[model samples]
Target: MPTFTAAAHGGPVKTVLVGRAHNELVYHGDVLNTTARIQAQCNALGSQLLISEVLYQQLEPQPAGQFARRGQLVLRDKA
Candidate 1:
């Protein structure tokens, strides 16, 4: 999974996946959360294995959407 940078109020964190990158790992995260009722409604279907949008876009010879659509991850807005 491509680790995307997140700019916290203090500064940018190298490991925090945010924006499009966070979207990539979320499907994996869903593996655990899917058992609970609430997460199923909010996350991608358990079958949609995905990579980061940046890499997916660079995936040439094939269309990017083969893996996942751009900006498909539904992240809760930061408070």
Candidate 2:
């Protein structure tokens, strides 16, 4: 079975084009990196989805049992 992971964050990002043809559009910024790092943790955490605290806080209140706290994770390239 194929497993998937997800993470979210709200912030600005810098967009740029790279490669010899300069046709590849890329999103570059801390927000993107942070989200990716969080997504990567899904395998280790054994969860289908992992969301960042910032995104969780931005969400509307949910049922008491809807979301479980997984605690803080020390992501790569982050202090």
RMSD of each: 13.7, 2.1
Question: What's model 2's overall lDDT?
Answer: 0.87
Judged by whole-model lDDT over C-alpha atoms, candidate 1 comes out at: 0.36
Error of 2 at 4 (Å): 1.5
lDDT of 2 by residue, 5-71 (tens): 7887778899999999999999988899889899888888888888888888889999998888989
Q: Among these predicted structures, which one has the highest TM-score? A: 2
Estimate the TM-score of every prediction: 0.28, 0.80
lDDT of each: 0.36, 0.87
User: So what's the TM-score on candidate 2?
Assistant: 0.80
* lDDT (Cα, tens digit) per residue for candidate 1, span 1-79: 8533221112122343457556532233332332232233233444323343434445466854454443554534412
After superposition, the stretches of candidate 2 with alpha carbons farther than 4 Å from their true spots are: 17-24
